[model samples]
Target chain A: MKKKLYDLAHSRAGDKGNTLILSLIPYDEADYPLLCEKVTPDAVKHHLKEIVLGEIIRYEMPNLASLQFVCHQALLGGVTTSLSMDTHGKSLSYAFLQMEIEV
Target chain B: MIRIGSGAGFSGDRLEPAVILAEKGELDYLVLECLAERTIALAQQRKNRDPNSGYDPLLEKRIDLLLPILKEKKIRLITNMGAANPIGAAKKIMEMAKRKGIHIKVAAVTGDDVLEHLDGQQEVLETGKPLSKLSNLLSANAYIGADALLPALESDAEIIIAGRVADPSLFLAPMIYHYGWSVDDLDKIAQGTVVGHLLECAGQLTGGYFADPRKKEVPDLARLGFPFADVGPDGTAVIGKVEGTGGFINLATVKEQLLYEATDPTGYLTPDITADFTTVRLREIGSNQVEVSGGRGRPKPATLKVSLGYHTGYVGEGEISYAGPNAYSRAVLAGEIIQERLKDQFPDLRIDHIGVSSVHRTYFGELREPYEIRLRVAANATDSENAAIIGEEVEALYTNGPAGGGGARKYVREVIGIVSTLIPREKVQTQISIQEC
Candidate 1:
């Protein structure tokens, strides 16, 4: 079945400087390996290409069924200088959740 | 077990919830973590104008509300209320205690400010630009760690005010003081950091910010209770909130907050220790009780993160609304008209369709033909007067250009942005002074 990543997992967004960190945590423990395989740094970078300008780095934690992505240069100039309405990039998690995955 | 309650997560957090925690939490320490990176720069500017006014705006209200309870309960207080003026805030707290006829001692932790120390030759970590390039440097403070705040614990004061210490360090210093934990105890320090991280956001782990209607409905959010932790001797912690209060705690909320702003799970760096969150474990042992363990640690980072705030020009913004038959088209027309109008004066002006391209910069799926739309134009310029031109040009569209354009609002303000760089630990000094009422 084709499902939105939101249905398979839940995520949160936080930022430091010009970088945004998104944590992709699955709703079920059984989906850990699926995320580990499907949700690569490239996939996330492509998913959020519009706002993300720099490189993307992903780290995994199998025990917690979670993946954390550090998206570089995502915020225009970060919270201090960003002209965007959503300065902190808090809403980017929903954009990440809108990604599709086959289950 | 030592109980520590997170009173205020940020500088502007609710004061009533903190008062509730002080009264009923049975906590030995009430730690309020305020002072975001940019808050100090703003505070420093206020201090420049008036020597004693640069502290937290709600410092007086927070202390006033929790004073009686804190005194009666004998709960020690620790907070970074001293954004740019720890001594000023401490004096204010002392006056409050004295006016209330209570004998309480206040400790002020200082030495985080390094604006005078910078030789204007260092490189900024974010942009790699030399500090000399930035003409007006507003403020620069090192992220002091647990070691700087540990001395405040040794004082016989009931409340400790700090300036620019790391948020986690505020909660970790209490655990270190109580347990007499050795500086070499990486495992314990990491555990303490994890506990601090979890509780540092106050109600975040207690179902306040995690609620999502039917998906994750929380009970009685109207009176959401703040969070508290009971730390064991081994550095493990069990998180909970005040009994009979609102908000719920479970594995989900704990997990969400665990990775809140943390970049590296394996190596969450603080000045006291490099915390490893990968090995950390969480279990909902009971209602609103989650046992947290498995936080390991490595050596602390050699350099401390320095937040430097500088002048970043002025922001001029104008927002106008369009509605009825073809609101989206009218808003788009307004955007184009404004673009053409301001291209000569402000070449870099940005136009955003509020409901469409403003958020993610692209609207997904078929548009429902937005019944109402808002057109926003913004530009950064050398000064406020120049920035106001972007709004003036947009307001000119009220009768000159687009049809049905109304509700135009314009604003121009100064902008201050932050850049970070690391400084060696030895160059900075931290101090603690006590004042009794």
Candidate 2:
């Protein structure tokens, strides 16, 4: 339910649209080692934690290994916003499971 | 006043229905269609193998048809032709225009290719492969949306060159400028984009790859047509192929094309229109054309991801069907003997499922038990020749090894590839500048 990750998350540099497009961009295999060096365990933890909020925790999905955070923000706000994106490889789906909000 | 127009699909070729319609009818806007995943991969490989190949730059080939018209009609254009090398393409277009004494000013949209620019920053998903795995990753492009075209339009450039923008927006963009359409009017924008999408692929909707290719009775086969978008002030755009062409359209052609690449009609995705594909309706109006109307859409997805593929490695796979109760044991022995023989020919090759569970049992219909076992062998080889050799190696099993070789047996070889890619959400769309001459 975090706004930054939901609103601001993007494909890394050179990959400007979505996750799938980044992977689709023909990249020189020489740069692959650079990718391994960048995915340090700490980076994942920090990035995942940044998207976490009250009653919302970050979790990676099965088979996808994609970072996702579950939340009750949709329920708390008494409003629903649903968005689904498919990139032959990456996908995102979310709904309100629970919530808490004041007027 | 310069009338800048971007079309829906491939209308310039004069072979597709879109082009036929445009040539037959009078229109201000004609868009062509040419972007897909398979295409992206093909174009990228073309550029990867040879940077100067100009495989991705759409405008270069696009100019074959466009240049003549722009000169004839004295019109302005904007297009997403910057597939691989936009700047290179722009240079070519400029050179062509100069020969005709046309002072062509083209705005090449740059800042999109981020592959080489990543400054020590790169990330991929869990598969554990990043930019490095793509050892030969030569080029990268994102499916940039319509907004990218704004800069070029404002410049009043004689032509605007682009790469990977949403197809509809390519046509809709000029409409946005001509009609002064706002971003908030999601409905109007969606309507305009549909016109673009409908005509993007030349023969797709125009009867090229229609359900029944023969029903339309198209004219000339050699000059396959392209698509054109003719939009009015109200956003009611009429789509058609070129005149003097072969293909004809009825309600069926339009309806089928609407459903092309659609599992759910209502969710047609585009940067400009989150089209409501569910309530779409089309009607045949004339002999060779149909009127496309009544498709509503929602807002665009928050994040649009570009797709990419990497060559993981070479894979060799094949299987054989075994019969009888000794299927499991026999399949195992067969695999072992095959691997042993292959190892000698293919040194340092890795063979999986060599012995254990070499066979999977299955039956037809609902109620079925392990009817017979199908044994499979998959090997990974660095060399391409090994793949064909492995097939011959596995098929040889029936004659040379194992006890219950079964009644009917065979081996098939298929190259295996482990493609690993990384896509961060924000970085999916890339913008590259198409320089002008």
Candidate 3:
């Protein structure tokens, strides 16, 4: 069955300069491996291609059932210089959650 | 065991929660981590304008409100609210204490400001440009760590304030001072760092930012409680909030905050230690208590991160609202008109339909016709005059382009850009001064 990542996980986005640090944690620890296979750096890069304009790196934490994605050149120019209404990229977490994957 | 509670998370966090922590949480120390990346730079700019006023604007108010409770409860306070001007902040606190007839000891930690140490030959981590290339540099302050704060804690000053200390260090320093944990004890420092990271955001660990209506319900969110950690000698702690308070302190909230802004979990760097969060463990032992353990780390870095704030330019923005039938189209047309008018002069101008595609720069989910839409146009200009023109053009739309335009608003703001570089730890000297009232 296909399900939105939002259904399986929750996320939070944080910014550091021009980079975005996003954490994706599945509700069920059993689904950790599933997300590990499906939610690759390439997958997230493609999912948020319109907004994130740089390289994406994913680090897996199996114990916590979480995946940390570091998206570089992502915040337009970060909080200080970005002209976007959402200067902090606080809304990007939901945008990442909008991804659909096989459940 | 020592109980440490977080008072304020950022510069503008709610005040009552810290008061609650000081009063009812039976805390030994209440740490308020207030400074952010650009915060000190902004403070420095304020200091440049007025040498005596660069500390947190709310420092006096927060101290004024919490002083009596803290004094009565015997809970010491450690805060970076002294941002850009710890001495001024300390002096102000002493004056406030004197006026209230409350005897108090306040310590100010200084020397985080290293603006004179830079010769402009260093590299800016973000732009890959030499520091000399960046113009209108406002301030440069190193992110000092737990060690720099040790002398203030050792001085036994009831209120300790500083500028640009790393967020977690504000919480961890007390743990080190109380537990007698060696700075070289990487594992212990890491454990304390984990606790600090979890509790530093104050209400974050207590479900302040986690409520999601039907999805993730947080009870009595109207009066969310802050969190405290009961730290034992072995660097293990149980995180909880005041019972009967508004928010919950369970495993979920702890997990979210553990990685809040921790970019790389494995190598979360602080001046005291390189914390590794992957080894940490969390267990919800009670209704509103979680036991956390197994935090590990490596040696501290040789250099400290220095946040550099510089003048970027100015941001001009204008927003106008439209409603009723064809509001979306009208908003789109209004945006196009502004774009067309400014395209030649402001080539990089941006137009956003607020109800449609503003935040993410694109829209998702089912595309239902919005009953109302807001047209927003913004751009960056080298000068305030050029920036104001963008907003003026949008205001002109009220009479010239859109038919139902209302609630038109415009803004012009100077942009301060923050970047980072590294300075040797030895180059930065920390000093502690104490005042009593």
Candidate 4:
């Protein structure tokens, strides 16, 4: 499970050009872990690292321990993009199903 | 030309830009969306920080900006900038308009900020918390139905101003009066609601930061174009964006906008329109235009929407990063230590989640478990001191232990709580204020 999450994170993000940012504004942090399950611990830490890029917007966490994490940035298929590299086949498929878009 | 045109836009601490658009287009009616659900606390916060800051933005600034424009342009506008402060908004608008060389007739419509008025008048579809608890609240602005717009309209004032009315009523009120459509005329009201809904969010439908966000090199989104409706007597209306604008609109844009800020489609409720979204059609026409037609709305509900969030306790946390060889392992140890200790202190339990990435693995991880665990432990103590003490104790762990990698402390304090409100469409609806400004 750990290896799969790790590989998915690398192959999908971390190249460092296509910056991806997520804002935890849903007013609940309970579902945050569930989101990061697909990614490795290292990837989560690296992206959420305060020093990474321009900004990482997280909400509702007033006294936040770490402003950054290897939380999954994906909606369904997995963490989508940012900082690394990965084939978006799973991502595209997931979105296609969720929205039923023709693409 | 006594143009009876109708459209939508924004109204916050300012209504100048909206008046400019109305005057430029020679529009007769303008709808402005000022208040939102999560904004009351924001309003309160602003009030606390600067007694004249929060709601004043929706009033003081509006008067200075619009008074002059109202004098120059003979247009009527309505706004829902009045959350717990319509009289404040109205008084400013009236006084400002007069000073700006405009002899504007205006009336401030109330009956929406019913933190008190919702006595037996309230019914709860959810938990039924009752209007009493809601009273004496920091602020109360009901989402009024279009029925509230009647007063503003009946006053025959060149402009009618109101407090915390729903966003749609800004447009619906004017349409009802011009078309003489009764509030109960669900179908017509639905059309008006549809128009208001489409135009209420302003540049959103015309391609603002939408859900299906399309990044267009619009001429200027900062000075974004608002929506307008050519509402007819039958409740049917033609809606479009500004003329010679950069963005283009069509059925797709309307549908995208319709579903952009999405919720349960069936549960779409605003005080003005009882119509179900299932009944409308978006027919494309000119490049930036779509005609919104066919609406079958329902009757207004008895109760206003409820905005509820209680004073939960306080919480705080600290952060330290792990980077070297055993960074991941060290991070986990740190999380366990905090969790184990917190268990003895606060049983609610502190939560820690771990994720890691590398140059090779991207963010999810590189073919293995996370390389580093970002540990975050949180606890709710009886008081802020209790919460801060726990957070500080965790901060100290990094200095003496292998688990801490980054530093001695990264601590911050704040009251975190879930803010939820199930306001009926009626409670959040914008009361229409058709002021000549």
lDDT of 4 by residue, A1-103 (tens): 2222211111111111122322121113343353333233344344434323333322122221111221233321112112122322222211111111111
Per-prediction DockQ scores? 0.73, 0.02, 0.78, 0.04
Q: Candidate 2 falls in which docking quality class?
A: incorrect
lDDT of 2 at B293: 59
Candidate order by decreasing lDDT: 3, 1, 4, 2
- Give the winner by lDDT: 1 or 2: 1
TM-score for each predicted model, relative to the true structure: 0.98, 0.57, 0.99, 0.63
Tens-digit lDDT track of model 2 for B69-137: 664554666665556556666777788777766666777775445555443234433233455644534
Query: Tens digit of lDDT per residue, candidate 3, span B270-383?
Result: 888999999999888888999999999999999999999999899899999999999999999998899888999988898898887899988767778899999999999999
Model 3 stretches with alpha carbons more than 4 Å out: none
Q: Judged by DockQ, which candidate is best?
A: 3
Error of 3 at B416 (Å): 1.1
In model 2 chain B, which range of ten residues has the least summed lDDT?
Answer: B356-365
Task: Point out the higher-scoring one by lDDT: 3 or 4.
Answer: 3
What's the best-to-worst order under TM-score?
A: 3, 1, 4, 2
lDDT of 1 by residue, B1-437 (tens): 99999988888887788988988889999999888889999899899999988999999989889888988999999999899999999999988888999899899999999988888788888768888888789999999998888888898689999889999899999899999999789999999999999988898889877777766789988888999999999889999999998999987788888988887888998888999999998888998999999899999999988899888889999999998898999999888888887778776788899987797777655678877889999989999899998888888889886789899999998888889888888889998888987
lDDT of 3 by residue, A68-98 (tens): 9999988888888887889999888899999
lDDT of 4 at A70: 16
Candidate 3, residue B148: Cα displacement in angstroms equals: 0.9
Looking at model 2, residue B348 earns an lDDT score of: 40
